[model samples]
Target: MRRVADHLDIPELERRFRTCPDAVEARHVQVIWLLAQGHTVGATSEVTAFGTRWIEQLLERYNASGPDALANGRRRNGLKPSLLTAEVLEVVRLRLADPPPDGGLWSSRKVADVIAAHLGLERVLPQRGWEALKALGWSLQRPRPRNPKSATAEEAQAFKKLADAVAEEAAAHPGVAVEVFCTDEHRLGLKPVLRSVWAPKGQRPTALGHHRFLWLYVTAFVGPATGETVWYLTDTVSKPLFADLLDAFAKAIGAGPDKRVVLLLDNAGWHTLPNLVVPAGLRLVYLPPYSPELQPAETLWTLVDEPIVNTFVPNLDRLINTITERCTNLTTRQPEISSRTNFAWWPANRVPS
Candidate 1:
């Protein structure tokens, strides 16, 4: 017989056993891995720091009932299973499984309400309600804006043509001869995010005792070929600040667009205004009206907003520094942005046949 250590395969064993809900639940799988390593149950238990009795019980149970039983038990003993057991989970599944009351898709709140009502819960306290649903893997999320102002067919085509032009031109240039920067601005509040909690059906939910609103603006640039990003953070996004941000972005890609620098930017008033000033090395191309998807930088901002800037920073200085540090770290980790080439400019009437 192969010795336990000789055949154990620790990495593979870890992968299999770690899938269990927790260390306690995974003990059986741990024993299996150890036993396969050629150790007796007592020895396996000793090495695993698990009790021999428990390991033996698991082994015996596995032999009698098989692998599935070892993972998910068929029964819970004694008390009757509450209707609320799968509780909000059933609510989500049923709602999604069928159409809503208005014969439309089920809304988040309605799903919450149905689950609470079905469990015969009078209050379905918001705190415990969200927790329960989350435990069952139900998350309340909102849809994002899509199909931006490409408000008109002509405008959408115009933006598409611009993006394709830049892409094609970069193909014509070789080895860092050109770079593309898809740029955009994101604004965030410095207040702690409001979290939904449970309360009695008719009772008002609790509110934060002290909360203040602050603002942050971020400018992000993305490289299209590789998904790399560079971001700048500021408190106020003024015209001059915008110009400064543009200069910084130009240096970021090693400037001198004589090599051709294409900037995929939005049609925000600042970008289009004839009065606004910017650096000479960079050239701007507009995204289709109402269209934000073409700008890869938006995806970068989503990551920043969701993970890095999700909560309030203490003060302006700390927030600014923190934002810069985080942006640098993210940019380092995602190095593909350096390769992004600018959009090639073409006349509005041009369309690829």
Candidate 2:
């Protein structure tokens, strides 16, 4: 006690040992406090659950630097200086856009090798390529799956114009209220859409599954303004099924003479109906070819599929039950649905019918 008393307050040390914010530092303090109470290094190690050599190192650091030394359990040497520069990294990024010299895509080792050759170095650590990417403001992201065909400039511009006009008209003609909703469908089975998960160090986690079974399809409609959704689960999707779904949707939303229900949908074969029975007071607004991005209802499929991901269903009945429960749960989460479906150009502040 007398030895450490000159440098550190005894009561202060006890208090810090009890309630220190940093777990690592608090552990070191506990070691010091036990030493102050006259325990040998070996005895302190047993009580503190630390190794004997670790205790000896702690004692050496404390004897040399006093209480301040105990605050940090380990000393951190400054990072090695970066050999890769902005211009070099930028070159790497641009060159990575095309196929690599040896392969289809650019990899960390290949990129590192390329950097070494350019800088006239004997070798560069392949691991540094990942670190350099982060430093250069690149992030690892799961790219959104999109179709190969792209929307042309004219199509996008036309959509913006159409959206603006719809907003204006809906606002101006509230009596002939135009209720715009987007609808889409998705298929589900026993297969899992596995995503990244937190796992133990150096151990990889896998979302394992068996053969596909009990397939089902879901068609849903979303109202961007009120976050209301109308959906149906069916065995298959076809023109007849679509017609039935559309009729059900019309009844669910109560489309009548007072308003026009503008239902936005994709250009699927089933969607292309020459004699499609669009119920009275309902209009089918077919989206541009190959543009799934335009349909707000496309977002609902993700929410609907959440229950089936990384999961197993033995039979069709069980899967249907699970999906229905999730659908019912989603209907209560109006705010979430609203945020996902809120199109920038949709009519603002109109009363939801």
Candidate 3:
């Protein structure tokens, strides 16, 4: 190949001709060019080495299709129509809307079987409901589980009462500037996800084992009224770390007793422990147990940690730095929640089973 380039002394021209020529005429032109350059058929075949018959047929095809045939041929393996038609789609829709005979969330395989039975399709054919939903532009997702140790009705009523009292207390005593803050920690693994590779048809791309340790801790503060957030990323979530964060916020608020910060955070043992000793201007208020939805900081974990941090971080330090940067950016960019609600939203509400 190297000698061929030097022999022809037209590397640029060869590249242009090969790339620009109509597919039909390209092979024929190349063969003629090689022959004219003082090369025998066998030698030219060795140099440009395309089949002689194929070269001739291409020349003929060029004469027939003009420049249009230069476009690549339509691939037979491209996406085809589903064997399951509109009728089958209707069956799937109906099955999904209604629960199975044995109540509870339908598993993917069970949903597939239900679809198969309704449309008389093979299980394998309906199993592809997984893909069909994507084709239909519906996100396939599972419901969150209800907490086993969830607050009882009486507990809920008590919380609601406390909430009202807290609101009224702050209202009557405007001197107490109350703010709810939720705090939590997150971890990151250090392994580069090899984005993606295009392979020859029917071949899977290779991958390396992911083994790396990257750790980080984030103390996030979210405003309940607006989903606005503030966060600090550090090497660990120790008492000193929490104390430092609290002290910073307390000093930032200054000498006004009216600027008292009431933190509505999780019941994480560290956050709740009395020995942790919250700063003077700041108070530690706990969110109802098992109620993550009420904590606006939970959004950060769902949105930031799972996708960007988990997938992209490759080394421990890089992971921590990425998280810190992202948290800082998000703190500035997050939109306020605007409306505040009394109770947390959950898909699985307490219902008689």
Candidate 4:
């Protein structure tokens, strides 16, 4: 039998146990009250549904700190000071800007080491390190891959130049309706596109892969402002084929004397203006070399791959059919497309003057 100190009278303990609003606190108070009334620890455990060991611990707490200790301890804060103070968090943020001391990716354990060193402590728990990261408003994320050959300054200058050219063209032809669009080509083949998916613990999801060389080209033209999309499927790509596609796109959009369409493109060999034919009312603007990040149409490939990813297709016809269905479905989801492709700095659609 554990002894409870003379903290409160039996009547006061009964009043507290009855008046406690929280169920957990009330249960804890009832345990103390039962023990204070000369009940054995085993008797209190049977009555309160608390374990014998836990009841003994509760008696120790009440004896040490009285009624204040009888309340749910979890609800009480500031009992133990945290080492991750505002100053320590600021130091962590600055350290994160550079590669970690071990020259690898940052993890909870690595962050724990950083925190421990900053406070001059021997060590900190990885769980506490993760909590500190959440407190600092940080999350784990995979970084987008950047091309080594991409010129940042040139990409910025090209964007500004494109914006100015659109403004200038709109001013030059006051009566002409000007619309901006991005165009790109994606190649889908018989090769399986693998992706990660959730499964039961200790069991990995499997995807069937059949590698073949047969290919299909999907050329996409998208209006970032409205998310209106035009898709063309072909067996292959050539300068003549690209010219025919442009003409078809122009006719489909009714881009003629009254409407001018400025098409943004990458510097592919066949896309250059040397011998290739370009239709009237359709002007081509090239993005900076090696800068696919600036091309809004590049983002569409992920959405295009959704139907075929991790699924095996028997032949080129099946792959084409699956992708065609996916494309048709994507056309109806304009808002989703716009949210993915519309960059903050993209030029807005200009109404005719």
Q: In candidate 3, which residue pairs get closer than 3 Å at backbone N, Cα or C atoms, i.e. clash? A: 45-49, 175-258, 181-264, 226-336, 226-337, 227-336, 227-337
Give the total clashing residue pairs for model 2.
Answer: 0
**How well does model 1 score by local distance difference test?**
0.62
By summed lDDT, which 10 consecutive residues of candidate 1 come out lowest? 342-351
TM-score of each model, paired residue for residue: 0.47, 0.66, 0.49, 0.81
Which of the two candidates, 1 or 4, achieves a greater TM-score against the reference?
4
lDDT of 1 by residue, 1-353 (tens): 32333233667666769886755557667787767666787788677787878777766665566555456343354333344466456655666667767787555455556766776776554444454455567666788656643556565555555556566556554443555557889876556544455668998655332245677888887765555676777777777778878888777776563455677788887777676666755667777677765565665654464433325456656656766776777777554443333223422211123
Candidate 2 lDDT, 291-352, residue by residue in tens: 87777887788788777676656777888899889988888888999999887866543343
Query: What is the clash count of model 3?
Result: 7
Candidate 4 stretches with Cα past 4 Å from truth are: 1-3, 7-30, 39-53, 64-71, 76-81, 153-158, 196-205, 321-344
* C-alpha RMSD in Å of predicted model 4 compared with the true structure: 3.7
Candidate 2 segments exceeding 4 Å error: 1-82, 141-143, 150-158, 161-174, 190-213, 345-353
lDDT of each: 0.62, 0.76, 0.56, 0.86
Candidate 3, residue 343: Cα displacement in angstroms equals 8.3
Using TM-score as the measure, the top candidate is: 4
**Over 4 Å off in model 3, which ranges?**
1-141, 152-158, 168-172, 191-209, 226-228, 253-256, 306-312, 336-353
Indicate which candidate wins on lDDT. 4
Candidate ranking under lDDT, highest first, comes to 4, 2, 1, 3
